[model samples]
Target chain A: MAVDGRDEMRPEDARIAALYRHATGEMPPERLDSAIRKHARAPKDAVKPQKHTLWRPAWRLPFVAAALAVVCASVVTLLVERDGGRLTVPPETPPPDGGETPPFSVQREPPPFSQSMTDRATVEPRSGRAEDAPTLTRKRAEPPREAEVRKSIPESKARIGERSAAPPDGRVLGAEPSHSSDAPASRGNKTSGGNAPLAYSQPPAPATSTSPDRVTAPPAPRAEDDSLSKALPAPSAEASPAAKPAPAANPRPAPQPESAPAPEAKPAPEAKALARKRLESTPSEPRVPARVSALIAELENEPPARWVERMLALRREDRRQDAEALLAEFKRRFPGERLPASLQQNDE
Target chain B: MLAYGEGDVAAFDELYRRHKGPLYRFLLRQCRDGAIAEELFQDIWTNVIRARRNYAVAARFTTYLYHLAHNRLIDHYRRRAPAALVSYDDEEASTSIEEIAGSAHERPEAAYEARQKAARLLELLQALPTAQREAFVLQHEAGMSIEDIAVVTGVTRETAKSRLRYAMAKLREGMQGWL
Candidate 1:
């Protein structure tokens, strides 16, 4: 046994070490050594790590290639399936229902002129004719006509006459001739803008007969004439060659004086009854034009200056007619509001 | 080790012969049970043979062999009953060096004092703590330095030195009269 620095150890340390050395002389039995030797010589195959066939390089590449091909095929199939299921429609054709109005038809009721004035200052000019066409179509699709306006004047007149005859509160029932007269003009506007060339080819005679009381009402008829005169001129400049002659022939001076006074001789009491019917039937909820409603919703949180900037941008885009109409609608919705100088200049 | 690792059975046989006595004796003394020692002795050798391919000469072959034997002995102690450990401390249950010496000597009167001294030394070793006893045994039987004892027992060299020092001090105190 190797003792560390044994010769230098204290005498007692040497004697104790010697005693342990003598005691350790007791050997392990020879059988234990034989058993160990037997184990050491025995085959060790059972303990050797086995070689796995699947992880061999020769087999790995083919398996990886097949898996990649399957993934690629699945991705291709998914893309093809997604692309195959959509429907395409052309832009120029009207919807299948022949009477269905094209969304851009200018014949729809103009938004209140005041509302459009506000809109003209703030709203961005619509991008181009293609973009403006769809927006205008959707905007004009619904006109803000009262339920009373939708009914025949005689029916509305009779209903109002009954209410007035009752006079529950003794308030004088005076129907403003403006309400009754505005309805037929709205209808005439719808026909003219929606069916354009077809509507223009027909005489203004039918429009006069449809609401004779409106035709006879003096100021209301002039307002209708003024609106048509203002509206017709801008469209005539841009109208197609085929559509150009139609507006000119349709709005000519010949028809105005003849159709203008047809509603003038109608009884004041009947007109009063119609106006009363309109007041009672008109819903209390304020009706905003669909296009303006969307703009207000979008900009309800925006400042007025931002509204003017957007409208000026719209004017610059060559969408002057739409920008003007939007400004007029904006003015009607927010009355007494002053726009920024730049927007006011553009509006003029 | 390198020769054995390269499939030289004779090299392994030479290593086994050289270490088998000290390694088995170390197990026997640590466990104090013949059958358990024999089992652990075989297991340690079997492990060395199985690990031949990975063996490198990082230390002396004796240190490597005894390190394996030291680990096997620990496993044997853990698996055996705790009662068996208590028996290692029981002087009457343990075989004394005097009893082993007495069997070899024919004249009892001539060897009586030597036998008694051997028996006393054995008792002192048995009374030492298991770690001290292991350090002493690894030192005396395997001729391991404090460094090899620490490697075998997985302790620091200072701890192995301390254990061996304590063991020798106790043994010397017990055998002071004989010295």
Candidate 2:
């Protein structure tokens, strides 16, 4: 311990060391020692804390939680059913596949994404030139693009304006030159005159399963449609004789797909106004998309700054066209206001 | 320590009883504050109790205990004075003339009577830079040999020896009359 001779305190250093020890030598307070004594004694018996082994098994708890959540959800759901619908879970909006399946058919097949989505293979026209129908069927497979839908809108509006705008007696596009008989069948649907929202027109089933067999009380006309319709008067039923039959036969138990072609079942702007009219006229909700009334109404009177914010939000919702429409509307609404450079870049 | 680890409560009490005085003095001198010293004193023992299960028979018990005390002292200084930890291992700090004069003015001129030499020695001890004072206290109060001091303080033996030498020289100068 003294190899470096630091241990050899000179007799003077020795005296100084002794002096320091003499003056300052004092033990810690008795209470502190007792506290330490208590701490020391406890750990001997506290060996039970080796619950470290519990963690090895604890890792499985995530799966346990998932299983418990699943079991609890299912048990609770069953109990709700058993209790005659008292303790029911929050209602999830059912996917509006083309036709409504009975409630018991949940998982009766892999969700109707199976029926309407992939196997829309069956919609090749039942009556038109067979070859032309496949192209429309293939086009419907992908959801309609914004540009194409926008492109279809001008044509639809022009056709509606051209055909319907003139007649003093309120006779709009009734007899198409191709389906002259088609006009009356469409006008007959009571709801045809109701300007339904674009969302009301659901997807198409294949021609066969565009199941007229399951037409639920023909969709009710939305209030917005009522407001919108007042802008354009209902075509006098006396004017088109075809507009007469659909409303008269509510459960027109004719299961074979009616006068509206299956291609109208695709939500293309292909036969926009007529199809919307026909969808309203049809007993089942046909995939007839109406005017963009909802967006204009929603974006109405919001703060000008918030317009771009809503546009950005629409873009985030993956409705890029809605975002663009809102942007154009914003530019029209606040013609002089400069949008954020980034939003303008995204718009470009 | 092995006996203590084996749950011999008597062994720990006997160990604490033997070392508590020097360790308390070591902490008191390292920190000039009494409450901080007491707090550090309790902390070192608490650590000792906590580490008892893993207490090995490698180093001398005083060395181990003082090693804990030394670390506790450095931690206390580190928390209080951010630069203290790095400055701690250096050679003795240079005391400024103003600081020396200020502390000197604080000394009781009348109390420098012969019997009060020990009190003056303590005041002088506190006036020394922390590293030199710690080395001197480790040598004197703990009675640690230079090698054991080096091990406890985590310095080389020569460094420890030089610090002790410096400390002894200063105390000798301050206590020249007593000598």
Quick one: best lDDT, which candidate?
2
Clashes of each: 39, 5
lDDT of 1 by residue, A267-312 (tens): 1333223322322222331443455545544443232334455577
Candidate 1 deviant stretches above 4 angstroms? A1-8, A45-348, B82-111
Backbone clash tally (model 1): 39
Residue by residue across A155-218, what tens digits does model 2's lDDT show?
A: 3334334434453333223332212222124422211111111112325432113212112111
- CA lDDT, candidate 2, residue B27: 89
**Whole-model alpha-carbon lDDT for candidate 2:** 0.51
Q: Which tens-of-lDDT digit does each residue in B1-179 have in candidate 1?
A: 78878867788889877777777778877777778778787787778888888988899988888888877777777777777653322123243444433443433344566666666667667766678778888887777888988898888877777777767766666665565
lDDT of 2 by residue, B77-149 (tens): 7788565443564443565334544554566666545436567678778867777788888877777888898
- Which stretches in model 2 have alpha-carbon errors above 4 Å? A1-11, A44-63, A71-348, B83-86, B89-92, B96-115
Among all windows of 10 consecutive residues in model 1 chain A, the one with the lowest summed lDDT is A120-129
